[model samples]
Target: MLPRRSRLTGASSSDRGLPNATVARLPLYLRALTQLRSQGSQTCSSDQLAESTGVSSANVRKDLSHLGSHGTRGVGYDVDHLRAEIAQAIGQTQDWNVVLVGAGNLGTALAAYPGFTSRGSRIVAVVDADPARVGEQVGDLSIESIDQLETIITERSVSIAIVATPGQAAQDVADQLVGAGVTSILNLAPVALRVPEGVDVRQVDVAAELQILAYHEQRKGHPREEAEVSR
Candidate 1:
């Protein structure tokens, strides 16, 4: 039997009411639960979830515990109930109005992504500094001028924004977003941003992720090279 610390808990002491590691893994659990629900699964074991999400079963159980969820020893967890719990925990139970800054290739692609809508976040406005890109169409949104950023945010009641501008322009856009009442930002730019105390920024650097993967590939190939050299 797992200890009390490993079992479901009613609360956490970490910042944001949950540990950062647990918060990060919640999405993985949610995604796995969503897939199971889609496949008509009514109950799933921690092992099953771990297999789907590539995490250790013990970690999976511990993470869910932080959300106050525990499964029966033999029957596991009710899939639908767990899914709802995770969604609510991650603030996906309600829709969030989001604004997009920068309408370049990466920005446009993000604006067109349907995954955000599934998570109850919708990009309500698209803005760019370049006048030529303004008035362009991205899905159901027309690119608006950067000049209208605050106005669009206020009119749409947007508190979340996606900053996909160039690395150089990202900080300026982030500043504008923070001034426009944006409390959360998804920054796709490679550069780090400095925002006010209460603002939350999540950075997504694709190039850096690829470089990390390249590092792993380099390590994996080194052993083969060493073996060949010894022959």
Candidate 2:
């Protein structure tokens, strides 16, 4: 984590219990700032960030305010400083050890994706239930059997897991992940997971997201639907 500088303003947003909506947008802002930094940007006004990210300038300022940032009224914010603050608030300052479950195509792609480590997560381990897949290499890590899941997780101090298993196996995999002491899960399979309190589960239902897009597309073609709703 960046050393707490005296120049920084009030308490961080995480400390102040920022709203869920604001917390979600922090990453978007961070990504935009990171891209700007890569492009040789040293300072960024909230309006510039909002414009790049498609968010309103007011919301960009409001969300950043929660993090205790006091940007110069006219000079804008220091890009690197703001990026570090956002990353720190989001716990990306510390490297999070991650474990990937399943060795299927989706899992393979995720394991190979360079973004996770670049964004502060390290894929320490990968596990699969299929014996045939055991010992197979995914990226730099060799796939281990599900039988070793608990042991590997305990030894590596893994706090987060990505589940890319088939829907039928997702629940069982989740149960094992919880039992193995994983605190957070990013489940890609389309299944409702029942996790105990204190455990965070973020589910990504690809089909459901596609369905939502389909709804929007249908409404675009059926303008009468919007007219009826206004009645």
Instruction: List the global CA lDDT of all models.
Output: 0.88, 0.88
Regions more than 4 Å wrong, model 1: 1-15, 224-231
How far is 133's C-alpha from truth in model 2 (Å)?
0.4
Worst 10 residues of 1 by lDDT: 4-13
lDDT of 1 by residue, 23-96 (tens): 78888888888889889899999999999999999999888888767888999999998888888888889889
Q: Where is model 2 more than 4 Å wrong at Cα?
A: 1-16, 228-231
Least accurate stretch of 10 residues (summed lDDT) in model 2? 1-10
